[model samples]
Target: MPAAVVDAALIVAAVLDAMLMAEADRPYAVVSTTVAALALAVRRRLPYLVFALTLPATAVSSAVVAGAVALYTVAANTRNRRTLAVCAVIYSVSCAATVGNHDLPAPTRVDLLVSVGYNIATAAAAMFLGQLVQARRDLQQRLAEIHQVREHEQQLVAQTVLAQERAQLAREMHDVVSHQVSLITIQAGALQVNTNDPDARTTAQTIRDLSVRTLDELRHMVTVLRASGTAPTELTPQPTLAGLSQMIANSGIETRLDGDLPTDVSAAAQRAIYRTVQEALTNIRKHAPGATATIRVRHDGDTIEVVITNTPATRPTVPLPGAQHGLIGLRERAELLGGTLTAGPTSGDGYRVQLRFPATTQ
Candidate 1:
C-alpha cells in the first residue's frame, strides 16, 4: 500500500514539473520528467538500474523529485555499506548538475547558493529516512528470534516434567498392585497341593502358572520405569506370609518367629503386612549380613500388627547399594490400606520395622 502511494506521488510530481518546464520554454522537459517518473516505479525492484537512469534525466531537467525517490530506494534496499556510499555520491552529483543547468535569464550568486543548499538538504533527508526504516526492520527481526528461542526452551521443560511424573506413577503402581498378585499366586499353589480331584488340581496349577507370568511382566514394567535395560534372567514371584517359613530357612542368619497369623484378614491388610516384612528382611540382609532376626504377627480383635527386628551385625559386610525406596514404598502401601508403618533403630541395639492395619477393612 505504501509503495503504491509513493509511486502515485512520484507521477503527480512529474506532471507538475512538466507544466512548470513548459511555462519556462525548456526543450523536451516533459519527455525527460516522464522517463524519470516511469523509472521510479521500478526503483524498489531494480534499485541500481533505476538510479542510473535517473542521472541522465536529472542532467537534462532542473526538477529532482524523481532522483530523490530513487536515492532513498537504493539506500533502503542495499545491505552493503560501500554500495550505498557509491549510490549516495552519484545521486549527489546528479542533484548538483540539475541545479547548475536551471533555466534563468541571468542567474546571480544568491540564486546559485539557494539552489545548491536546497538540493543538499533534500538528498540528506531522503538518505536519513531510508536508514531509519532499515534500522527498525533489523530490530523487529531480532525480537522474533528471541521469542522463538524462549518458546522452544519452555517446551523442553514441560516434556521433562511429564516424564518424571510418569516414572513416579509407575513406581506407585508396582508397589501397590504387585502385592495382591503375589497373594493370588500363593493361594493357587496351596490349592493345588490340598485338592484331591484331578480336575481341581489341574485348574489350580494353571492359575499358579499364569500368576507367575504376570509377575514377570510386572518386573519388566518396573525396569522400564527405572530406565534400565537389564532384565532378570529368571523372574521369580514375590514371597508372601505362606512362604515365610521357607524364606527364613534359606537365610543363613539365625531367625525366630512368633505370634498367631490370622487367615481371615482382608487382602489389603495382608498385602501391607507382607510388604512390611519383606522390606524389613531385605534391609537386614543388605546392611547386616550376620544379624539375628525375629518375625512376629499378632491379631488383637479389630487390628493386626506385624513386627520384624534384627540385631546389630556381628560380621557386617559391605552394604549393598539399592534403589533406597524400599521403606518409602512400604509406607505408601500401609497408608493406602488405612494402616501405618514405622522403621528405625530400636532401643536394644537393633533395627525394628512395625506395621499395624485395621483387620476387617480393605
Candidate 2:
C-alpha cells in the first residue's frame, strides 16, 4: 500500500479507538489517551519515544491502539531483536495490568493468566506484521538489482553478435571484391603490353593504376572491419560532397553534375547522395555503354532530392551478370532514414534514379 494511506489509516484507528474505550469521565485519563494517540504521528522518526508516550494509555484502559501502532513501527524500522523483545514485553505487561489498575475487582489466577497470554499474543502479532512489511521491501530491492544485471548481459550479447557480423562482411569484401579487382589489374597490364596504339596503351596503364589503388583502399577497409571496433578507423577520409567532382572524373563516364548543395548538409545525407550517384555511374558503365549522364541535386522546401539520368547505350552493350542488389540496398537505406528512392526507364529510352529525403540542417 502507499505510505500516505497507511499513515492515515493508523492515525484514524488510534484516534477512534481511544475516543471509544478510554475513560472519558476522568480528565487525566482523557489527556493521557489523547497524547498517546497523537504521539503515533511521529512514530517513524522517534519509534522508542512514541512507544513510551503510548504506555500511559495502554496502562489505564483497553485502548492500546497507539501503543500497538508505535510498537509495529519500531519493529519495521529496526533490526535489533533484543531491544524489540524488551519493548514487546513492556507493552504486553501494560495491557495485562490495565484491568487491575482501573479500580476493578481483583482478578483470579486463571483470568489473569488468560489476560496476560492474550496481550502477549497481540504484541507478537503487531511485531510480526511489521517484520513482514520490512521483508517485502527488501525483496523488492533485490529484484530490481537482478533486473539491472539482466539488462547489462543483454547489451553485451548484442555487441558480440555485431562483432561477428562485421567479421563476416570483411571476409566477403576481401575474398570476392579483392579477387575481381586483382584480375582487372592483371588484364589491364596485359592490354598495356600487347596494344600497339599509344592511346589504348595509355588508357590501359590508367586502368591498371586505378585498379591497384582501388585494391589497396579495399584492403585497408577490410583490415579496419576485421578489427571489430565500434567506430571505424579512418584509414582514408570518408567521401563527401567536396569529392563528388573528382569521383565523377575518375569514374571514366561522360557525366555533368549541376545544382548546389548546402555546405551544412548532414554527414549521413551527404554520404548517401555520394553513394547513390556512385552506384548509378557503375550501372551505366556496365549496362549503358557510351551513355552521357546528368546529375542534379536540389533542396525543395524540406526535401533534399537528387536525380541521375543516363542516355540509352550508344553501342551494343555486353550482358553483364547483375542482381540489382545495389539499388535494393539504396532503397533500404533510404527507408531507414525516412526517405524514398525510385528508378525507371526515362521518356527518351534512358534510365533515371531519383532519391528524396528530409533536408538536414540546411
Candidate 3:
C-alpha cells in the first residue's frame, strides 16, 4: 500500500514539474514528462530500468523530481553497492549539466558555488534516507532470526534437563528398592529351610522366588536408566501375564485369581500389566497387610483388563516410610502403552486398582 502511494506521488510530481516548470519547448516537455511519469509506476518492480529512463529525461529537460525518486527507489530496494555507485555517477552528471546550461545567463562565482552546494546536499539527503530505510529493514530481519534460534536452544535445554533427572531417579530406585528386596529374599530362603509345616515351607519358597524375580527386574530397570545406548546383553527379559501367578502367590495376601488371560499381548502392554499388578500388590502389603485380595484378568475383543482389589486390613500396623510415587509411575507406564489405569478406594471398605489395554492377538 505504501509503495502504491509513493508511485502515485512521484507520477504526479513528474507531470506537474514538466507542465509548469520546464523551460523546454512543449513537444520536448510533453515527451519527457510522460516517459518519466510512466516509469515511476514500475519503480518498485524494475527500479534499475526506471532510474535509467528518468536519468536521460532529467538531463534533457531538468525533470529532477522523477530522477530523484527513481534513485531513491533503486537504493532502497537494491542491496548491491554497484547500483548505488551507478546512481551517484548519474546524479553527478545531471547536476553538472544543470550548472553548465549555455542558454542561461552567466552567473558569478559565488552564485555558482551556492547552486553546486545545494545540488550536492539534495542528492546526499535522498541517498541517505534510502540507505536508512534499508538498514532498518535488515536489522528487523536479523532480530527475528535470532529470536527463533533462541527458542530452539531453550527447547534443547529443557529436554537435556529432563533426561538427566530421569537417569538420577533410576539410580536412586536401584539403590533403595534393590537393597530391600535382597534382604527379603535372604530371609525368605532361611525361613523355607527352617520351617517344619509343608504350607509354611511352600509360602516361604514363593516369597524367595518373587524376591529374586523382583531383584532381576530392578537391576534391568537400573541398567536401562543408566544406559545411553542399546541395552546390555545381560539384561533380563521383561515379565508378562505368565509370571502373574508367581506375583500373586508371593504377595502373601490371600488373593483369589480369576479370568482367562491371553498370552500373546505386545511386549509394551505386557510390561504395563505386570507393573500395574506389582504396584497393587506392593500397596496392599504396605497399607493393608493381611487383607483378602482378588486378582482378576479378563480378555475381551481387542481389549485386556486387570483389576486388583483388597478388603480392609484386619490388624492395624505402623506405616513404613514411602515416597508414594508408585501409582504415579504406573499411570505413566500405562499411558505409554496406550492404556489406562484407575486406582482408588472401592465402594465397600477396600481399595481397587484397575488397568485396561488394547490387546494384540497371537
Instruction: Report lDDT per candidate.
Output: 0.70, 0.78, 0.72
**Which candidate comes out best when scored by lDDT?**
2
Question: In model 2, what lDDT does residue 131 have?
Answer: 89
lDDT of 2 by residue, 90-190 (tens): 99988986868666678889989999988999899989998898899899999999999999999987887777666656644543465456556655766
RMSD, model 1, all Cα superposed? 11.7
User: Among these predicted structures, which one has the highest TM-score?
Assistant: 2
Instruction: Candidate 3: list runs displaced more than 4 Å.
Output: 5-20, 78-83, 99-104, 227-362
Model 2 lDDT on a 0 to 1 scale: 0.78
lDDT of 1 by residue, 1-362 (tens): 68789788887886676566533556565676677778877877898888887777666676677777788887787788788777777777776676556445766789778867777787788777778788888889999999999899899767666665555555554554554565565557667878999998999889878876776677667666656311111112444567666656754557788987778866556556765766676567556756899988888888888889999977534323344456766776677767898889988779999888788775
lDDT of 2 at 48: 90
Ranking by TM-score: 2, 1, 3
Per-residue lDDT of candidate 3, residues 255-340 (tens digit) = 88888777777766776777777778777765775578888988887888899999998766323434445666667666666778
Question: What lDDT does model 1 reach?
Answer: 0.70
* Runs in model 1 lying further than 4 Å from the true structure: 2-24, 105-111, 194-207, 219-362
Worst 10 residues of 2 by lDDT: 229-238
What TM-score, over all chains together, does every model reach? 0.57, 0.58, 0.55
**Global lDDT for candidate 3?**
0.72
Question: What local lDDT does model 2 show for residue 325?
Answer: 47
